[model samples]
Target chain A: MTLCTFIKAGLLGGILLAAAPLQADDLEIYGFMQVSGSSQTWDEDYGASLEADGALVGTWIDHAQQANAIAGSEMFPWQGLVGLKDNTRNDISFNLQQLNVILKKRFNRQWSSFVNFEVVENYKTDYAQESEWGSFSVQEAFVRYAPSARWTFKFGKFVPTFGNFYEIYNRTPLQPYLFRPLIFEKSVGGILPPEDYLPNTMAAQVSGTLRTGIGKLDYALFLGNSEESYFAENGRNDTDAKCIGGRFGIRRGLFKAGVSGSYDYDRLDALDLGNDVVLAIDYKVPRMRYGVDFSGSAGPVSFVCEGIFVVYDLDSDQQAVVDASHAAGTSADNTLDKSFFYAHLQYDAAKWFVYGDYDFVNDGIQPWGKDGVNALIGGGGIRLTDSITWKFQVAQYSYEVSVPHPLFGAPDPLAALGGDLTPVNAPAAGVYKGTILDVQTGISIAF
Target chain B: MKYTLTLLVLALIALRATAGVSVIAHPDVDAGSVDKITLADIYSLDLLALGDSDLIVFDLSDADPVREGFYAAIGKEHDKMKKLWLRAKLTGSGEPPTAVASLEEMAREVAATPGGIGYVDSASVPKGVKVLATFE
Candidate 1:
C-alpha cells in the first residue's frame, strides 16, 4: 500500500477496534526513540560506504519490523525464500523506530484482556516500498485467563511461541543494539524456509509457574498455524501437521536458564534432472529447531548465553535428487544441519553500562566454507536519566571462509543466482574478509 | 560552624539511611511474618497467594525514602525493580505494584481492600492495617 493508504487503514482499524474502550488510567503508553548517527563500511576494502543521515523512522506494518530489517543480516542466511531479491547495501537509514499502545484492563477477578495496536513506517533506503497487509498489523491482541497466580491461558494472535529474544528483547526500547542476533532471524535457503520466526502467530497457549525443587519452574505450550511459507499453504501450513513449540525455564540462585524449540513440516515440488534430466519434481521438507539459554546477574554485572541448532531432513526422493546433483558437481548438503550461537556479557556501573556479544552461525545455507559468521560486538551506554541513554558501539564480523569475489566488487556467479538458484554449485565466493566496521552513537529512551 | 554543618549533614544521611520498612497488609489477612523470599515474590508479583487469601501489591512512590529503603532491604535497586515491572507489563505478566503518593495512603489502601498488601515507612503506618513483616 502507499503511504496514504497505510495512514488511513490504521485510523480505520483503531476506530473500529475500540469496542471495550480502555479506561484512560488503564491504558499504558510506551515507546522508544532510536536517534543515531552511523557510518557503515559494507566492505571497507572495496571502499563501499553507506552513511546514515542521522535519523531513522520506520514502522511499516508492525512494531519494529523495519528496525528488524535495518538491523540487516549480520550474516544474511538465505537469499530468496519469498522469491524477492533483498538489496541490503542501499538500506542505510532506518530510525524513529517504535510506538506501542498497550491496553490492558481487568475484566473481572478471573480474566483480563490485552491489546497492542502498533503502527510502523514501511520505507526502504532504496526505491521500493511494499507491505502485504498495508502498514498496520496487530503486534499482539489476546485475552488472558488467570485461574490462579501461577497458571494462565491465552487465546488470540500474539508473539509467536519461540525464543526469549523474540518474546522479551525484540522491542526497540529493550534491545541494547539496533539489530537482532542472526539466530532469531529467518533467512533464505533449504528446500523450503521453515515457518519458525514469523513475528506473530494466531495461537492457543498455556503457561505457568510451579514451585518445584529445581528452582521455580516455568513452562509454556503452544500449537498454531505455521504461517510464513512458500508452499501452497500460506499463512497456515502443513494441514496434516501443525507446529508444536514452547519454552521451559527455571530460576536458580542468581541465574535463570531455559530450553525452547519448534518443529515444522512442509512440502514442495522440486525441479530436477530426474534420471532423464528434464523437470523438477515434488518433495517434503520437515525441519526442527531447538535451543538452550542461560542468564545471570551479579552485583553490577549481568549476562546471557544462548545456542540454537536447526536441522532440515530430506526424504528419499529429495536425497536422491541431492545425490544426483552432487554427482553432477552441484553443491547441496545431504541433510542440512545448521547451527547458530550467540553470547552476551554486560556490566553496569553508576551511570555507565558496557556489553560484549558474540554471534556465530554454521547456516549451511550458503556454499561450503562460506557458511558461517563469527562476529564480536562491544559497546557502552551512558545513562543520561532513568529513561534515556546515550550509547556508542562497534561491531567486527569475521567470516569463516574468505570470499574470492567481494560484494559489489566482481560479478560472482553464485551470488548472481542468489538463493533462488538452488543447489548453489558454482561455489560462490564467501563473505568478504576484511575490517567491516559499524560505528554508531544513539540517544535511546523508553517510557 | 563547619563542625556543626558536618554534624547536621551526618544526621540527615543517617535518617535517610535508616528508614524502617513496614510490609503491611489488610487487617483481615491471616499471613504471618513473611520471609525474604516471600517478600521478594510479593513485590515482584510472582507470589500472589498468602495462604487462603489472594493478595494485590502496592508501593510508595519511587522517590519515597521508605520505598528506597524497602527495595534496598530486599537486595534490589530502585531502577532495576522499575525495569522488572516494565518487563512484566510488556510481557503479559502481572502488573507492577501501583504507586501511591505517600506511605499513609499506601497503608490505608492496604487496610481497606481485601487481600491488599503494601509497604511503608514505620512512621506513616496507619491504623486498621497489620504489619506482616519489618525490615530494620
Candidate 2:
C-alpha cells in the first residue's frame, strides 16, 4: 500500500483501539503539540575573487549570495543550510514544529510497552497535495520488562541513554526554550549530527539503578544497527559492524552527573575527484565518541553543561580520498576529530522562567575557514496553565570564514577546458565574518 | 485588648495555612516509615516497588495546597517533578502517579488499593491506612 494509505490505516487502528472498552489504568494515550513563529536576520561581510587564464578578473557578487553559496555547498554540514538566499535578509515563518502522540500499555507490574509517533514541520500526508517541509514517522516503539525496581530490560526500538538531553530534546514540553542547544537540535542538521556524536536509537537495552549512601548510580548498555547515510533506502545496517554504547551516572536529590560513550561504523556516500570529475564514492569509517554531562538545581535557579569529543578512524586509503575530495586545503591534518560543548542556566518560578545557553562546535572539517562556531541564546517561557506554555527565544550565532572558498584556488576542474582559474585578493587575515540573529516564539499544548 | 485578640487570630490562621502532611500507604505494605530521600524517590516515580508489592502512587490535584506542601517537604519543585515523570513515561521507566480530586479521595483510594501510596494533611489521618512518613 501507499505510504499515505498506511498512515491512515495505522491511525484508524489506534483510534479503534482507544475506543475499545479497556480499564483506564491498563491503557494510556497522551501527546503534545508545538507551534512556533520565527524571524531571522543575517549580517555578513563576504568577498571572493575570480581569475581567468591565471590573470586577475574582477567579479562583483552579492554578499548574501556568496554566503548562501558557501553555506549550501557540501563543504560544510551546517544546520539550517536550506532556504538561505541573501545577506542582511529578514525571513519570517510560522511552523507547526512538532506533534507527538504516545501510546502506553501496562500488562501487570512486570511488563509494559510504549510507542511514540511524531509529525514534524507541519507534516501533511494527503495524496493529492503533500507538503515539502514536514515529515511523519514513528520515533520509538519498545516493550519493557521490570522484574524489580532496580532492574529492567527493553526490547524493540528506543532511544538509549546518552548525554543527559539527547533523549528528551525533541520533547518540547519538557524543554524551557523554543530552540534546543545547538548540539542536540537534530532537526536543524548542523556541525554535529547527533547520530554521529551519539547513538540515536537502539534495538535492545539493559539498564538498572543502584541506591547508594551518597546518591543513586544509574547505568545502561544498548546495541543497535550501524549508522547509514541519508541515501540508504532501508533502515538496516549496511555493514556487518554494529553500534554499541552505554552510559553511567549518579544522582542525588536534584543533582545528576553522567559520562557516556559509543562506538559505531558510519557509511557515507562521499564525493571523490577523479580526472577532473566529481564522483560519488561510498566509504565506511569507524567512529568513537565520549561525553561528560552534569546538571543541578538550586532553589529557583538550575544549570547544566556537557562536553563531547568525536574521533573518526579512517584507513590510509580512505583518508587519502577524503583529503582529495573534501578537505583539500582546509587543514593539514585531515583526521576528522571534532569536539562540542554547551552551558545553560535557568531561573524558574511558579508562572514564568528565564534561561541562557551558550554552545560551541569545531566541525572537524573546518569548512568555514574558522576555528569554531559559537551560539549564545536567551529565552523565557510563561506557564499559561497546567497543560499549556508560551515560550520565546533570541539566539545569536557568529563564525568567520573566507569567501570564494580556498578550494577554488586548487587545481581547477575547468582547467581541462583550456582555462586556467585562480582566486586573487582574498580576505586579509580573517576579515570575513558572519552573524545570524534568530528570534522565535512558540506555544505548546500537552494533553 | 481588641487589637491583641485580632493579631492572635491572624497568627493562628497563618499557622494553619502552613500545616504539614503525612505520607500514607496501604496497611499491607511492610515499610513502617520512610525518610525524605526515599519519599522524594517514591513521589518522583523513580522508586517503583515498596517491599514485595509493586507501588501504585496517587496524588491530589495540581492546585491542591497539600500537594504543594508535600513536594516542598520533599525538596522538589512541581515543574521539575512533572518533567521527571514525563521523562520516565517516555523512556518506559515508570508513569506519573494518578491524581485524585481531594485529600479524602486520595486517602480512600490509597486505602482501598493494595500497594497504593498517597499523602494528606497531618490533621486528617484516616483509618484503613498506615502512616509511612510525616512532615511537620
**DockQ of each two-chain model:** 0.51, 0.54
lDDT by residue (A337-400, candidate 1, tens digit) is 6677788898988888889999877634233324466778888888898778888878766553
What lDDT score goes with residue A408 in model 1?
29
TM-score (all chains, Cα) for each model: 0.78, 0.82
Q: What is the interface RMSD of each candidate, in Å?
A: 2.0, 1.8
Off by over 4 Å in 2: A1-25, A47-86, A123-133, A190-192, A230-234, A269-282, A323-327, A330-333, A402-431, B1-9, B18-20
True contacts kept of each: 0.33, 0.43
lDDT by residue (tens digit), candidate 2, A30-95: 788898888888776653333333322322243333343443344333322122222455668777
- The weakest ten consecutive residues by lDDT in model 1 chain A span A54-63
Please give, as one word, the docking class of candidate 1.
medium
lDDT of 2 by residue, B16-78 (tens): 768878999999886988888888888876688877868889977656667888888998877
As a TM-score, model 1 comes out at 0.78
